[model samples]
Structures are given as C-alpha cells and as structure tokens.
Target: MAAAVAPTDQGPLAGLRIVESTAFIAAPLATMSLAALGAEVIRLDPSEGGLDHQRWPLSQEGASLYWTMLNRGKKSVTLDLRTEEGREAAARLVCEGDGIFVTNLPARGALAPEALLDRRQDVIVVTLDGSPDGATAIDYTVHAACGAAQMAGPAGLDSPVNNAVPFWDVIAGRTLAMGLLAAELERRRTGRGQHVALSLSDIAMETMANVGILPEAELSGEARPRQENWVYGSFGRDFETRCGRRFMLATVTGKQWRALLSATGLGTAMDRIGEAFGAPLDDDAERFRARHAIAALVQDWAGARDLTQIADAFAGTSVCWSPYRDAAQLLAEDARASPRNPMFARQAHPGVPPVLTPRTPLRLSAHPRLAAARAPDLGADTASVLGPLDTAGKEADP
Candidate 1:
C-alpha cells in the first residue's frame, strides 16, 4: 500500500509527481535530480529493498550509504512486483499522480513503458536501457565499447585504462532528467504524453561523436593516442615541486608561456632551450612541439622551489596551475564542512552516525530550497501511499 502523499513541493517542478522504478546509478540519479528540483518522486523498491539498497559502503549497523546518497528527498515503497496484485498497485500509484514514470527496468515486463502507457494514456514514460534492444550494458561496458577506455591513460600503454569514475552513466542520467522535464512541458502544452527512450550505449556514442575524436580518426586515418595528465595536443604536464607536491600546469598561449617562464624564473633557460631547438619560444605550436624540452627545463626550476614559493611566484601570473589533491586531502581541506560546496551536507540516519551525504547540485533562486533528508527505511511509506490501493487490489483479485 502507498503512503499518504507528502506536502506539495515548491520548486520549478512543484506539484509534479514522478514514479521511479529504477535501480543503479543512471536511472536513480535522474529521478534524484527531479526530486531535488521539487518533483515529488515516489521510488518503488522490492520487498527486500532492491539491488541498489544492498550496494556496498554500508554503515556499522548495515545501513546503505550508497542508497541514501542517491535516493534522497524521495518517498520509498516496497512492493512484490512479480505478483499481479503488486503490478496493479504499481500501475495505480503511477497513474494516479502527474503521470510521470521513469524506469530502467527491462522493456517487456509489467512496468514496461507500454504497460504504464496503457494504464494511463497521458502518462509520460521515460525508460533507459543498456541498448535500444535492451542488451545488458552498464556504464563500464558502454565506456569500453564507446572508445573512451582506449583513449584514457598515459602514453605508451599497451592496455586500455578504465576510468575510476563511471562517466557515461552520469551523462546518461543528466540527459534523462532533461528529457523528462521536456516531456513534462510538452504534455502541458498539448495535453498529450509521449514515451522517451534512452540508452547508455547510444548516449556514449553520441557524446564521442560530438567530441570529434571519431570524426578525426575517420578523416586522418589515425587513432588519437593517450597523453596521460597532459592535455591532448596542448602544452600541459604534471610537475613536482621541491616539497614533493604535484601540480598540473598548462599554458595555451604565448603570453601564458611567457607568464609561466617569468613566474618560475625560467625565462633564460627557456631562451637557451628555444635557441637549441632553432624555434621561437613565443610560438605556441613550436613550444607544444618542443613540449618535452620545455617541460624538462621547467621541471628543474619547479623541483628547486617549494609549493609555497611556487604559489607566491604565480600570484600575479596567468600560468594556469593547480596542485593535485587526493580524496582525503580534498575532503579534509576544501570540501570538508564547507557551505560553498552545496552538494554535501551533514545528515543522520538510522543505525549510522551522522555523515556527509550528497544533495542536488541545482539551486533555484525563486523556489524553496530542497532539503537533503535521509532516505526512508525499506517499505516505510508503503502504508501511506498504497494504503487504499492495496485494499482495492485485494478486493478485485477474486
């Protein structure tokens, strides 16, 4: 049974309702974004809290930090969707509201887009799959198939490097949110809803196409090579300071090159190196072509100065540079307990100590701020939302 509907949200999506039948990062993240934007998202989980609720990084008392992070600011209801009664209830919950249904579930089940659309003609059905035909492809597989895995990592590597971050899943999720919002607007304008289908594979391929690497390969008959920390075809490299701090430096223009040389007191060394190469140091293309030589010269200068001295030298220069910070260092210093980083906030949940959880990154000047509350316990809102619907399902089951 469903729980009583919560108070009406007041963001741009205020009064809008979304039924989320999704698991994992992409689908859930899409609904989470909508919820943060003031849509009342009702998440349908299984009797056992579903696969996502069991993902790792649990608390000492077996609470899922991963689930809480993605499912924030939404209502949760557990149902046995494998049964006819449960499927009917799921349809009822979706049909009764704003008629927005978002799911990554397989396209041929009770919760399929056709099933939901059949149940409510005006419902907006947004479904995401691994592929258009529903072949199983998560972000990692899609990333590999889309050529990103081969493009990442350092130069001269025989093997492809997988990024620690699942880039495609995030992109797909954000795109899905945009689609859902667009569908909502269209429905409002025409009083007609539509089915929106998206695939992680397609999303990755389209992004790569726009990125121009594949087009460049087709035109030049050469695949782009990995450049590691250096920007591809740009003047950039990671250098270590005297105190062993690492910094990634880049200079895109001749002025920035001159600024870098002046900032690091390497102008004379650069002039000598340029003379040796028979190239002018002021030409960005020439400097990039001689990047190895210039990098070596700058490394010597940077390696002799501590990070503090480097900062002082770079204070008035436009030689773009930033120190590399690991997760612990970043969290403990800049992102730790800072209001400027609106994505993170302190929240306490059952069976877990208060910890930092991520919130929606979107901020609205005209709407009430979305609260980053803890996710509900499994099936916690079942009675409130599906209460009357559950009874009706049983009464008609005969």
Candidate 2:
C-alpha cells in the first residue's frame, strides 16, 4: 500500500519489485539477493518480528547481526498476517509493482497464491517449504538425511560430523532466486504467471546426486568413509608449517601437481614413488592412490619451513593453497573480506555498529555496482506502506 517509488536507474534488476514474507535463511536470502541487484523488496513480518528476529550472532546491543545482514537493502513492514485486515493489506501490496510474492510461511485466506493469482493473472508467486509432504525440517536435518554429514570430518571417526555451514539452505536460497528470475522471464514473454515451489530437502538430495554421492553409494554398496581434509579423487590435504600454522593444499590439475612438485623440490622423489607404484602421479586417480606417500614428502618439506616461507615458495605458481584462518584473522588479513574488495563496504544497521557488508557478488558490465545498504529497523516502513490503503481495505490512487 506504499506509494510506488520509481526504481533507481542502477543495477540490472532496476524496476523489479518483490514482496517477501519469510523467516530464517532460504526465503530471506533469496529476496535479499534480488534486493542487492536493485529490486525493491518489501519484507512483511509480524507486529513484533518474525521467528528469526533475534537469531544469534547478535550485536552488543542485542540486535541480530544475522537478520541485519540477511535483510539488507529491504524495506521492513510489520503486519499481523493472522488478522483479516493484515492479510488483505498484504495481498493488495503483492499485486502491486511487478506483482511478485515470495514466502516460506504458510499462506491461507487472502494471502494464498491462488487468491493472489485470481486477483492478478500475471502475478508470480514463489514458495519454499521444508518438504513436499509438509514435514518439519531444517538444514542440519536435511544434511544428515542426505548422507553428507556421514562423509564429513576426520577419517575413521565413529561419529557423523555436521558442518557448521548450512550449505543446503544457502543452495536453496540461490536456487529460489534463479527460479524467481526464470519465472519473471516467462511471465514477460507469455503474459501469464505461475507458482514456483521448492523444498529444502530436495535441494540437499539433488546436490548429493549431482555430486555423484548417490551413485557411488549405490555402486559400491557402502557409505563413503570420512575424508577429513583430503580432497576426493585428488591429492589434497592439510599440512602444518614449522611456525605451527596450518594450510590446505590441493593439486587437482596436472599443472597444479607439477607446480607443487616444483615448489617443494620433490619432483625426483615423487617420480621415484610413482615408479615404485607402477603408475605415474600425473593421473588424478593415481595420485589419489599414492596420496599418503605424496603427502608425506610435502608435509616434511612444509614442516621444515615457516608459513611465510611456504607461501613464498608457492607464490605466482599454479600451486593451489591457502592458510587456515579464523574469522578474526580473515577480517584482519584477507583483502577480499575487507572494504578493499569492490564487493564489500562498511555500513551500520539499525542497532548494530558498522560492519563489513557486501553487495551482490555479481558484476554487470552494463551497470555500475550499488553500494551495500543497511537494513531498516523493524516496522520502519509500515506507515509509508499502509498509508495509501484506504479504510475500505483498497488501495487509493497515488
């Protein structure tokens, strides 16, 4: 019900509009991604806030940093969708600019996709659910069920290790963004709208299949053993330097393999080991088979040098390697994680101090990148959004 503001003449998605009602990761991330590309996203939450309003990684003032970062560049509108008036207002807004609606929450009454589409045939509705059958689920549960957790962590460990990152949720978010754009394109071409639905569990399962985990399990009749830091089907793992710092090194390509050998001065020794194994190390599978021997020499060479020396040895070479760093170290050391990178800017949110934030990683040759914008305080835009909605629950003319 907000007065329609003309989209800024910047970024690829300039003129696009999206109305979002979502919580936690996937749905919020999808809209935020579009917002970063210049879509005007209006996010609807309950009068107080949504379930993730106080999600952890909070600032000292108890503001949710997670929510702040995820909701960046979005206008916040608080509406008690449990009421008829609130739901009507939401439906009216959804049928406005671009006629797009996205949510992971249950839609009923006036907020239903069918009702919205009935109101405007060309409306695009995107919904994300935990499962096709409506079962309750989350990233950790999906990851465990998909068999990924079993294959993570140290080799020979008895317990399955869940990754700290919610990869499935992240993937689902990007997938939703892609599907939304595809739907928009289809609507533009045919002048018809349809609903786009996805399940978080499906994303995890499909990713496992795409990465060959399912086939490997089916063919081998066994679950994959945990690999720790070792790269699958290649020679890669972690090594410690004399300075007691650890780094991950991987040699997937022949060029990378050769570079590692050159950097470590172990070409002759590796060649001898390859001859002893009756196969050349140039082949990926062969290197994987002889990884223990290969890693031993590399580890010894690395252990004799400091982390700086190791970095110097591999500098400007095709040797793919990176030193392990915690979050603080990453912020302090990596230029890409700091304001030095075009993707990042330091910005303050509603109740949080200025922190390093990011714009869309996508670069458009035609449009200049937009600066990262702060998230609005809760319900900050409610009056602006609802002001134009007349008492009769209809949008008045601007």
RMSD of each: 5.2, 4.3
Q: Show model 1 residue runs off by greater than 4 Å.
A: 1-9, 107-110, 252-262, 267-287, 315-319, 336-342, 388-398
What clash pairs does model 1 have?
Answer: 1-382, 1-386, 2-384, 2-385, 2-386, 2-387, 3-384, 3-385, 3-386, 4-384
For each candidate, the alpha-carbon lDDT, in order, equals 0.81, 0.90
Q: Which candidate ranks first by TM-score, i.e. highest?
A: 2
Evaluated at residue 27, the lDDT of candidate 1 is 91
lDDT (10s digit) by residue, model 2, range 169-253: 8999999999999999999999999999999999998998899999999999998888889999999999999999999999999
Which residue window of length 10 is worst by lDDT in model 2? 1-10
Count of clashes, each model:
10, 0
Candidate 2 Cα deviation (angstroms), residue 143: 0.9
TM-score of each: 0.88, 0.95
Any idea what lDDT model 1 has? 0.81
User: Residue 252 in candidate 2 has what lDDT?
Assistant: 91
For model 1, the run of ten residues with the poorest summed lDDT: 2-11
